[model samples]
Target: MYHRDRSPCSALAVSRSVERPRAAVLLLHGGHEYGTSAPGAWNLPAARMVPFERAVRRATKEHDVLIGRVRYRCRGWNGGRADAAHDAERALHELARVAGDVPTVLVGHSMGARAALRAAGGAHVRGVVGLAPWCPPEDSVRHLDGRHVVLLHGDRDRVTDPKASADFLARARAAGADASFVEMRGSGHAMLRRSAAWHELTTSAVTGLLGLTPLSSPFTGEGRLLSGA
Candidate 1:
């Protein structure tokens, strides 16, 4: 129930698009490498995000929304000038054009999660959902100010530091943004375990961010806060 669309003038790859939607969800996948120009295909992130994309679409089916999965042109981000971020910027612009100022939330993993946070300052973006994000200390934490950001990081994740996410949330709150960090237990970067928990957490966060539903309580665990009133 998704359409495969490619960016004619740019390297933005839309895995699929929805029709007559009420809202939009832009998905950013993880992983990037240098020598992207030497690639034979758009091998960045491969199809690792397909399952998540479908999960988003399925989760939001009742909400009547569009889910856009982006395959970036530049597959690298290390000392790479946020190439994926630039692609996400264009992808958001195109999404706004297609969806017309709809309430939008960015959902991304790792590298894509950082891009989502970077590009979330756009006019139509209302919130972001980052899954096991890989954020450097240099990544601007101010761009996420005043936007709803829900970070789902696995406590067992060895790929991205969960502590970084916690630190980012503290910074976001200090900047007066409505943010939350759900420290997922017993799950890794892939989030293969506790499937129901992941889906529910994601759906609830998306709906609550868009004001379609009441926000979940921040009273979750020790030494952590959801950073909202």
Candidate 2:
């Protein structure tokens, strides 16, 4: 069953199949670079993530995995305040409270992906899947050591630079992370063009990072870029 819980920093819509989940996945959605207003139920960014939530639920139906969709209290990163990252941190704390120290994966898109990557240093986080991430040069990779990080960016994305993500991947690797980058051809920042491929790659990365299953052949190598045509 699904339930919604509101925290000081964000809200979480959680669905769990078992009483005690063995693992968890948290979904974070995109937003602008600067906005402080709270996102309502129908907010396009939050709504856009619903399908990915369903995809994760279906992919992990047989397993004792908890799926959570996080809604940030604010609409943007809001400069160095990083409102969404703080919200994501709080959500991770809540997940820890409900599921113990179980391994967790964070899946985020665009600005949300930036938040996920920032919050990935949390104790429960085992991996991160960033779809069309908005990675800036100053983003840190120091916290990513020993963690699995997968960045999927479309070459056609004009909003978030795919090249920036590649640079971040390189930094993550240098910092001892198991990081890789996937370039989606003919796709854009919203991820609507090759949506199926995005979903497939995300599910594959999540399950694989959690050790529930082996990563698909296409995503096996380090720093490899797969065609998402």
Candidate 3:
């Protein structure tokens, strides 16, 4: 069943399959580069991630995996303040309170991906799935040691630099993290061009990171290329 959990700066749409979850996945939605306004329920970026929430729920229906979609407090990254990442960290803390230290994975898109990557240093975070992430040059990979990181970026994206994500992956691997990158050809920043492909890859990545299943072909190898169309 699904329920809502509220915090000072964020909320969670949680789907719990068991009383105490064996694992958990938190979904973060896309947003702008700079905006301080609060995001309402009907916001387009939040709405865009609804399908992913459903896909993950279905993929882990038989397992005791707790799924949560985080509603950020603001609509943008807001420079170095990283408000969204703080909210994600809060959500993770809340999840820990409800689920008790079960392994957790974060799945984020666009700006949300940046937040997830920044928050992946949390003790409970076991892995991260970044979709068309916005990885700036200043982003660091040192904290990702021993964690699993998978980045999926569309080569055609104009909103975020795919090359930056590639560079981040290179640094992540060199830093001792089990990281991989998937170049999604023909897809763009919005991930609407090949929606199904994005969904499939996301599901596979989540399940694989949680050890419920093996990763799909694209993520089985380092820096694999996949057709997003």
Candidate 4:
């Protein structure tokens, strides 16, 4: 069953399955407002999370998927990746408290990616997935050691630049993380639903990262190594 609630901090959207429960995917929205609940108020610039939601639902046909569209300060001095990560960590803990101890996968876009990485620090998170995540702080590299990370970026993305995500992924791999990169050719930063390219790539990456074999996107071999910025 999927549930939506308004918390003192931010609004919550969760979907869980009673049958075929595996792990959980925690979706975090990109930077926008601090803590406001209004329609389309927190729509991130380059991070299209709507289709990601649908993709997760389809992929988790046999598992539970939870999405948390948080509203934290993402503007002004207090509104940055660091603050986003701090608040996101709190929100994940709250969700975990309600859902019990289940394996978690963190999915973030843009600034949320930084937050997800920070939250994964010392937590029981299974993996971290960043979609067009910006350059993280140098100190943040230590937190990703021995963690599973999947970084996705569009080759035509101009907002965050594909090379930025590639560089982060490279550093993540160097830090001993099981990190991989996927380049979506011809796709822009704003992911269009029903987009064959976007759908295929996301479906493959999400499923593969979660240890599922997708018949639609069969694996032949690892893709190309995206060069650093």
Off by over 4 Å in 2: 1-3, 6-10, 225-229
TM-score of each: 0.84, 0.94, 0.92, 0.77
Best by TM-score: 2
Off by over 4 Å in 4: 1-3, 10-12, 15-21, 32-47, 73-81, 137-139, 212-229
Report every candidate's CA lDDT.
0.74, 0.85, 0.85, 0.62
Return whichever of 2 and 3 wins on lDDT: 2
Best by lDDT: 2
On lDDT, the stronger of 2 and 4 is 2
Candidate order by lDDT, decreasing, is 2, 3, 1, 4
Model 1's C-alpha root-mean-square deviation from the true structure amounts to 3.8
| Model 1: per-residue Cα lDDT over 8-78, one tens digit each | 55534555456676788888878754435422355546455666676666666677677776657656664
Model 4 TM-score is 0.77
Q: Which residue pairs collide, candidate 2?
A: none
Backbone clash total, candidate 2: 0
Q: lDDT by residue for model 4 over 25-138, one digit each (tens)?
A: 777667643543333554554246777767777866765544455455443113443567766777677766656666677877776676777777646577777776665335
34: Cα error in model 4, Å: 9.8
Worst 10 residues of 3 by lDDT: 220-229
